[model samples]
Target: MMRRLYQSLMAASRAHAQWEIETTTNIIKNRKMLIILLLMALPLIIPAMVHAASLPEAIGGKAAYGPSYFSAKMFYGSIAIGVVAGLVTGCIGAGGGFLITPALMSLGVKGILSVGTDMFHIFAKAIMGTTLHKKMGNVNVGLAVAFLVGSGLGVTGGGIINRALYNYNPVMSDFTISMIYAVLLGFLGFFALSDYFKVRKSELSKNKIGLEKLTPMAERMQSVNLAPMIQFDEKIVPGGRKISGVFVAISGAITGLLAAILGVGGGFVTFPMFVYGLGISTYTTVGTDILQIIFTAGYGAIAQYALYGYIFYTLAMGCLLGSLLGVQIGAITTKVVSQSKIKAFYAIAILAGFINRIFALPEKLSQMGYISLTPSTGAILTNIGVWVFFGLVAIFAVWIIGTFIVNVPNLRAEYDEGSKAEYNAEYGEDNKAVVSTKRGAAQ
Candidate 1:
């Protein structure tokens, strides 16, 4: 039973990862999307760069790291975080975003700024990437709209709560954020580690299961008939399934609340809620997850946090730039590496994030006078957490990049073979027209 639960969680994680990968792919390959994102970002960037000093004081009086005062160190730091995150996202298909907030906090970024900046980065990415998912026929428009309505409400509430707490006391706000991360990441990390061990044990026993069976909870949710039923993914699931829109909204609300509090895109929450809690098809879940991120993150970033002067434009943009390249490289690397290897790394990455947040909690609490600790001890513990967290991430990044470099020839050959097969299937193996068209396009 425990194993089954772990399997379900792992499956949900995979669903989230795939959604992220598809979104990242769209951001990288779609020229129009790239242009649109750049255009949207320019107005915000220009002012931040040109009038950095005149900007409103950030929460807690920390100067906002606007683009104008671009620090090479901060830029590189953001890129490093992005590259690791992208590698984790592309390779494992989830858990990459989990690291960003904790990483930023460890780097001495204010808690509110980390949350706000991360949300903005996610909103930016979602805007560019969501169109592709819609085109691919994965999205259920009715379901997405309903979910966003609830998510919007949740974001507003969560944002208000965060700001209210920050206004009351910065230490309390930091403590609150750290505690949230500790609990969520701790739970997720524990389960992920368990799942990893289970997989290892199964491999040794020669009794591996590739996919998790749908849970009884999922089955029960699907059977529930309530008002305003949402019909989704008729083509994927025969005759499709209908569930209460209220249930979906509830799920979205939870996702949004967590996202606003944690500074994530909420795909991590949405994927599981739709697939397991609400019993939506993975196909529909992926589509809806992508669709809702834009709304949830956008509202949370702009209305909830940005208006309060919590966003760091430079960090967000730096992450965006680095992630684009990192995701591409990481996605390509997956073709060369094995899934078992990927799963192991995913577990490690999540646990590293959990450890980072959990260890930092004591320091935050100490500052809030919730606990007694010397300044030196708190600083030392925080430093240790930061180092261990980043070390694991750095090692994982190196492993992925090294593997990709070593297997480049094999990946290239495979790509060439696949392209040729696709070309032949579409235009025939000996079609001169295909060659001419390709040559013309290249020219």
Candidate 2:
């Protein structure tokens, strides 16, 4: 089950990465869209510059890092964070967005701010990238409507909870977020590490991979004949299947709640839930997930976070900029790197985040008076975790960049050779028409 879950999550991550690439490329190409984004951002950035809050003023806590104002330092630092996250997603192909919130907290940004900022960044990307007409054929309108109905409710509830906690005590809010991250990261990290070893062993033994089996729960859910059923998978499956609308909505609620709180767009679990929980076909699930993610992230970020002033616009933009470059480079680098090394690095990166979150928890607890540890001791442990997490990520980034640099010549040669082969295959080796067309275009 853990292995299956890991595979589902990885699949979802790949989908999200593809969306990022497409949207970012379009944003670059469409100057009108780029101008609109910049225009929208200026309002947020200019106001923030004039009315930036100090740490204490923002959160009613001690100003540990001084005023929480925008600066070049913060901008560049956020860019670096985004770059590492994008590299992880592009190269390792899973669990990259998991780093953003934790990394932000380590940099002294409040947890709520981190979560909200990440959500906004995702929302912006989704809006720019959405090409709904192409995907409409695979999307079940009824099913999507039901899910969004539940998701909207869930987002409202989650937003209220986060705000209430912040109102009660900022430290308490940070503590809650930290604890949630620690538990989640720890669970996923262990499973990822186990998967790495399994893959390594399989490679050494030269074993063939097998298809995934469906769980009994999925079969049972699909068989349920409850009223108001949502029908789907008509194009692929013979006659398709029907499941209760209540079931689908409940799944959406759960996904939306998590997205609202964690700012992950809930993509991590949507694929698994649709396929394993509701027994939906992967073909239908992919299209639905994409549509749902756009709505979920946008609604959560705008109605919940942005309205509440939890978003950091400058940081979000910086992250977006950095991630675009990082993802392009990382995706290209994947051609040269070994699969085993990528898997190993993915495990290490997740564990590093888990360690960082878990270690930081003690300090938050101390601040909230839930523990009796000395401040200095807690700070030391927190710093250690922060350094460890960032150091591992930085090292990984350096290695990826270095590998790309070292193998540029070889990569270029392979690309040219592949292009030539493709052209030859298409036009034949002695096709003068194709040669003339290429020359004409160049001229």
Runs of candidate 2 with Cα error greater than 4 angstroms are 28-71, 131-133, 201-214, 423-443
Prediction RMSDs, each to the true structure: 5.6, 4.4
Measured against the true structure, the TM-scores of the candidates, in listed sequence, are 0.83, 0.87
> Candidate 1 on 1-443: residue-level lDDT in tens?
55544544555556555666777787778898778768855765555444333334553223343312233455567878988888888877767787888887776677877899899988877776755545448888879888998899888878888888877876677779988888777777787676667666453123434222355777787788888888986886679878889988888888898889889877767756776677677667766776677788899999998888888877888687767767778889988887777777887888888888878878778877878999889888888888989999899999999999999899999999999889889878568777988999999
Best by lDDT: 2
Highest TM-score: give the candidate number.
2
Report the lDDT tens digits of candidate 2 across residue range 1-443: 77666666667676676666666667767889878877866765555445445444444343332224444456667889889988887787667788888888788787888888888888877787566566678789878988888888888778888888887887788788888888878877887778678767453213422212346777798788887798887876779778888888988898899888887878787878887778777667777888888888899889998997888888888777777777777888999998888878888888899999888888888888878999899999999999999999999999998999999999999999999899979878569877889999999
Error of 1 at 381 (Å): 0.4
